[model samples]
Target chain A: MNLTIKATKNNTFDAVVVGSGMTGGFAAKELTERGLKVLMIERGREIKHIEGYDTAMKQPWEIEHRGKTTNVSAEERWANSRFWGLGSEEVVNHLTNDKENPYIEKRPFDWIRAYHTGGKSMHWGRQSYRWNKQDFEANAKEGIGIDWPIRYEDLEPWYAHVEKFVGVSGQKEGWDVLPDGHFLPPMPMFAPEVHFKKMMTEKLSRPVTIGRIANLTQPQKVHTDLGRASCQYRSKCARGCPYGGYYSSLSGAIPAAMQTKRLSILHDSIVSEIIYDEQKKRAIGVRVIDQHTHAVTEFFAKIIFLNAGSINTAALMLNSKSNRFQNGFGNDSDQVGRNLMDHQLGSGAMASIDGFEDDYVYGQRPNALYIPRFRNWGNDKQTAYLRGFGYQGGASREGWESGVNADGFGADFKKSLTKPGPWSIRIGGFGEILPNPNNRIYLDSEKKDKWGIPMIVTDAAFVENDWAMRKDIIASAVEMLDTAGFKNVTSYDRPTHMGLGIHDMGTARMGRDPKTSVLNAYNQVHDCKNVFVTDGAAMASSSCVNPSITYMALTARAVDYAVKALKKRES
Target chain B: MLGGAFSAPTLMAMNHWEQATSPTIEGAAFSLSDTHRKIVAEIAEMIIPRTDTPGAKDAGVPAFIEMMLKDCYAQSEHLSFTEGLASMEQVKFLELNEAERRGVLKYLEQQTKEKMKAMPKGTPFWRLMKELTLLGYFTSEAGIKASFDYVQIPGKLENIKLKPNQKAYAY
Candidate 1:
């Protein structure tokens, strides 16, 4: 197919967001509401609110394969690695197929993602947390990496702004490390979790709280206005929530942006590169390859926001080399694909609680109890590692699958399974992996994906800091469970490689100097002011908590800055 | 219960003769032989015998396992499981009684556990049998309501103390 430059020199939008995901959605909404005509391009198919979540209302028995993975599809398509549930087939079709978009892994990495209008936001864990002052000051304090150009104070207001709009359900304990957020009513804790929390506080002098999730326990005006209801506690948010209970791009940002009537969205438009103009010294627009027809096209915009995730966005920038910028766009520092980071996880344990057989819960709780980071805090800075980790876990009665070996048949088995099984709890850690320049991702120009874009080659691996933290992560969980008077407490530490956490960040890190980083404080490329990267790519450090919430806040703040800068003719 | 709607004799007939010998049903291959199918059906019934409710055969667990194995299990897993069944036949070839056959199965269970400890990889034959047995039994109406009480649309959360005679949930 022939390429057509629809917008010659006049047809330029106020802003162009290159992804309709967690960050892109917020960017579109914030930019459009600021009275700017924003054009959002998504690499995947269009998924509308409520109507697109066909399997959200399905019961346990209503699915085929009963949540089991099949070999036929798994072998045929490499994208099956991202496919989890029974009803995730349609969404799986939109994800980057492993066979078509291959990446060489020095170590095994589970890069789970779904590329759609809302991107992985539709399937996010929804656990939102604010990055504390310490998290912002980590780089400068430790002298590990480059200092973040902006501190927590600059982004705090934006966090509150996004939090209120997203309707986070969290208890305000006033912790300095994690900080409080603009929250809706917190989800009630399970009795076991409450019991454990009390015990842990009394014994260890550490606090355990219900996870600061983005699920609306109590519907606020913002949620109600957005046509979202309180969570029905279905725990099936991964399939996409029809009630719009959880804060996804589809449930939150996209609809708000659509309300502005200034935003236009084009899905299945895989952005190949941001076209850089030599004379203007700014991004003219972007070239997109239509996923279905393989048709190449270009759309013009005065400003461009690349929120196409961490690796992909960085790869695009690396692929956008021109006569002026020979190495790559904004590669003066050569840090465009350096300092890659991901949370190290799956190193924890579960134990059986003999009691709570009769007392069963109402619904599958979407959120888990969280144990905030206790290491490197206050007088307890003595650790085998420098950074810290947090735990997310829950207690529940065992299902029928738990009693496989029990001797019974017809009547006895039926009667036994009608009630709840023995109570059990699991605690898993999400530890921070410090941004190491050695841990990086680069564009493999030799290989091209199905979209004809250069494949991202990852060469990241967890180091001693991660290994040291994981030891305590497992031991602490076992200690808590044992202290709670729980019997049969056992600990486990699964072997994990980097990127398995699926929280990839910091490839195009923000720094005070252009010589040290790709993006500046406001997520604008220091060398090229017209281009911005508000995704995980701009993260200076990988905080212990999930990073998507932070990305949303950053995107909103950046869009506000970008729109104002454009008005001021700064570009 | 849905399982009780089918009589014991009817289930036994279905177990022994009905659709067991058919190599192809509607152009789809039905792999297991009649005798092999009966063994699986009877073995599953013995594991969760008919006591004051419908048996494994009544719950259609035997059929469920057969279909699940054919569709879901890898070729190596299917071979291992069939090999396990053949070993059981080897015990019977030594002119062992029904009780003796059960004793051999008990021994096999212990051996399987030891093997699992040594190698924590893909699902083994005994593990597959156990998994299928649990899945089929729990999902069955008699298994769900009788063995473990189920509440469809449990609207509210209640924290009630367990009675001495309270049964667990099937699922």
Candidate 2:
């Protein structure tokens, strides 16, 4: 009995974070640094910083397929994902093999996932933008979905705090559409991109700026202290940056949390269930299963944070059923895996630039130009759609890939292939998808993965407003490119599904009422106060922006609130 | 006298093969015969002949092409490629002179473009050959280092003025 008590005590901590991903990394950092003993659990293999990047510096000759996934198994792994470059050898290990982890796509959901220590942070396109005041007010103003319980002011300070630590590199555009944040020096734009931006703003009357990315442009003391440095312009971040130039969980928060010495990490341990106490009416602990060995272990904690991304986070809650909460953990609202939302994308335009062949970029900028949302703003309201969409793209000279169509065969032809081809400008729209109860993911009790976890059944598609918005998204992209006076402008709308954006959100959303939402204003489960979810799952609305930075801010805020509540209760 | 030992194309290919002294690789999945390999090698050279810098054959592209066909391509997809070579063999491609070979490549190129309309999920033979050779050659070390301005790490990302005859960046 004494041995049992000691073992139980050994498992207990101040907090247990269910993932070591983007938000979980921040949660661990915030909680531990605030003097809480924290244990971050991850189902994927732990990646030690720098050294774990197996193919970061591999030359083109060294890669067998030369960046193309021409092999059968590799094709099947990335098939139907619709993401173009994830199949390359450089980042293959970072992606989840689709065959091995198949989700039942009821409506062809391209559910791309990354289950690793850093999670999708390793593979994230680091475009970080703030959700303006309108983004928070959209749902309530338009009656599209449930209102966001907290407004932008609630998250403003948290965003600043997170950005200060994370080192966001961007220009402070004074536009209300994209609220400026704490940022490092902005990365310089290429000549063609600069020309495109000028033309776009001058003609189209829209704001176009260099992409607000999370790369370290100028390393500060806070960044350098974390062993993070300035960007090397190699653009090999997909394989994991050896120099910690960009911010992955491994590159930033995890290390900071480790420095606090109040943090313990568990890799390859999947959090299967959040254990709720019947008497306390709160989450007391969690049940974890070893991803490899399949051995189950129960861990106790005062506070538990679920940051296992949007999909797996909802899955974990739905799987954790008890006598009191028979539906799922914190499912008193019956909204555990509903109100699914993701950004609709993969529609864009490209055009060739005839002149200015006498200019070239020196380094890989590793960022694109951003055209902020213009449609459906205050004065620019449209009857077609409720919310607006932003465009992300840049201009560049055509590389060797363009040579495939050109007639080529000898010394002169080969010489032409070697020379830089005509400059071309491209733009893609990332539009907002309104939250719908039908567009959701539920656990399939019939099927289980190799790890014995229930498989996710995704049923989501673009609805009426979404499709209506997409037509504009495509039209706007082409208009911007064509109006910029580029030659041979062409538009393409590739096959896109809900999860293709990989911005899986609004599953267990935060709202005003516990009856209508899973999480409260502070991202704490309403029925279960000690348990919080600060990942994409907590998003009430799918704002038209890259959401990783928002997740970081929310996670930091939740930890601060949770820790203060814990201390206050003790007093 | 030299034509007696080999075909006319082989006699021409031998002249280029002296630069590509790398031993023939036996692909575990797929590979071509010595005659077919020599024909492909000569085509690779013609596509990117030795200029001021080393050409495709010098970069040992024949072995890389075989490796790509072995691992990257399916048997069904490469069958047309192999059959295309056989068709070329039927037309005495091994005996064709330089100008005739160039015309033959051009003819195959046009034919492949027409066949591409009917072909599903795979490139036609002539298109595949040209693309594969390009893929193999340009990704090779000699192509990256010798031909282009290879920069392993550019510390700055500012826009630089493009000079005359500036080669593309080998990133």
Candidate 3:
């Protein structure tokens, strides 16, 4: 069925947000509160907040495979091979099924994504950290790629704005690389972690802070007003938190946007392209295909925001080719699909600590300890690489799985396993992959998905710089453990593949020059004033920290600019 | 090209071949007869030995291993396991008469440490037997409560240092 709705003179809304995930949710909430009639389009099925997480409350024994992947479930694994979360088998429908819609990986790139109403915001690790001043000014000073048109100062207010609403729990140590944020009370460190932190700070003269996460260690007014409660400390967050303990688009942004009553969300509407009017020289509307009926429809808006994630947003722009912009929409500079980047991880060390057998953690802590970036900053330059990486790790006592080799059958083995096993510490580094033009994603017209849209061909890979950093990531971790006098210190570097970090960014980068970038300082398309791409695609550089919090701040800032531009047009 | 090479039917046939050739314990050995398969399954049960908690058989461990060997294990793993099973049978025959299989198993337990270290990590029969035996035994109601302290809903965060008297968690 083909459905067409003609836009009346007054039918156009103040804004149209293309996704309902981390950035899109923030966009909707920010714009709606600012009095914009925001229409949010989500490609996945609608899910009600607590009710949607079917397996969230289930115990380990309750699952059929006991969290193990079965043959039938293994077939669905390819769809979300890019993502890293448990219960993925039961929640396969929320992600893009690779069998139905496969993307070509010229080099093995795991483009893990969840396309549902909440997008990746539902599955995000929730480790929220602010990008220090160095992160914003690095590209400009180092003369790699383009400078971030907006600096830390420009985003500081917005960061404060979003952090208060999001309820980030972290202690303020006033570190230069990691700035302080308006935070709820920090979750106390486990005993082993406290020991490690003391050693790192005193011995290495380095700061080791508890993970600055978007989890509520203490309930604040914003969360309480929204009818959300504190974390039950279950640590089963990726399965989806019914308690609203962790921040997700479903629990936080969407509900807040809905409360404004000016925001409308439409699910299962796969947006094909932004309808750019050549005569008006602005994005007038968007064309979408109904996922269920395969019916084509059109919705008009004065302003269009593309928050369909990095690859999807870039593909949409490339697919939206017209006579005026023949190569692709907003492709005048030909930079729409270049400079794709993601953090390279899967390189770290795990060692057994012989002592501390008597110590065991009380509950499963949802967050890990973070070692902020100490290398290649403030006169501490490395001969090998320019940018640096940070470590996220923790120590935990072994459980029943530790008794795999131990001898015994009935009562003896049972009695032995009641206490915790030896304490072991493991740390993994999230190193920045520089914005090289060679690392890119392109539209493969030869291959089409189930939606009939051309498949995204990813050709990105880690270069020598990333490999060089991996060496330090392993060596430094071992050195720290050895210096701390932990016995049996061993380091490991697991072979890492691209896209494993799941923090893909920098495809449609923001820059001052239209010739060098697709989006400008305000996240607006350099060529099209009315179009904005506020998701990871607009990132100029991939910082070592988790990118979700930055995405939220950028989205809030972009919507503020877009609303003002819309008002100026009206006046 | 890779997809074309391993069509669904071909993959399934390969899986069945691997399963049919895999080695088994004295109680459970690979043979053409269904009765032989049943005997092997029973022997697997004896190795784990059912008690208050569900044993290897009760946890469907033997069946799970059989299915895994057929579907997941490589051909080399199947051959190695089969060889191990044949050796076990030879040892049992030499050690005692038909009624002395349990006695032979008891002797094998004494030599388990050296024998297990000699076996490779990926051998199908031994690996599956070991994994399922542990999984089935531990996840059983008796295994969880009696063997280890099971905490279904640990409502609060404590992060305590374990005392000498503290019981181990069943996680």
Give the per-residue lDDT digits (tens) of candidate 3, residues A1-571: 0112332334467788999899999998998899988788898778778888987877554554444544444455564643444324445545665565578988878877777879988878899999999899999999999999988999999899999999999999988999999998888787777888989888987789989999888888899777678877778777778889999888899888888888888788889988888888888888888888888777888888999999889888999988778988998888888888999888777777776666676667789999999989876889998789999988888766665566444434544554677788888899988998888899886877777888899998889999899999888888888877777777877675777788888889999999999998999998898999999999999989999989999999998898888888799
Per-residue error (Å), model 1, residue A58: 2.5
Which residue pairs does candidate 3 place in steric collision?
A362-B159, A418-B167, A418-B168, A419-B167, A419-B168, B23-B82, B27-B40, B27-B43, B28-B40
| Top DockQ model | 2
lDDT of each residue in A216-278, candidate 1, tens digit only: 888888789989988876566777887888998899998998888888888878889889988
| Top lDDT hit | 2
Residues B23-90, model 3: lDDT tens digits: 44343333323543554465566555555555566666655555555444455555655664555444
lDDT, each prediction: 0.77, 0.84, 0.76
Interface RMSD of 1: 3.7
Classified by CAPRI criteria, candidate 2 counts as medium
Index of the highest-TM-score prediction: 2
**Candidate 3 chain A: worst-modelled 10 consecutive residues by lDDT:** A1-10
Off by over 4 Å in 1: A1-11, A76-96, A356-358, A405-414, B1-31, B48-60, B91-107, B120-122, B139-171
Give a tens-digit lDDT track for model 2, residues A508-542: 99999999999999999988899999999999898
Q: What DockQ does each listed candidate score?
A: 0.29, 0.55, 0.27
* Model 2 chain B poorest ten-residue lDDT run: B18-27
TM-score per model over all chains = 0.89, 0.93, 0.88
Instruction: Give residue A99's lDDT in candidate 2 (0 to 100).
Output: 81
Shift in Å, residue B48, candidate 2 = 1.7
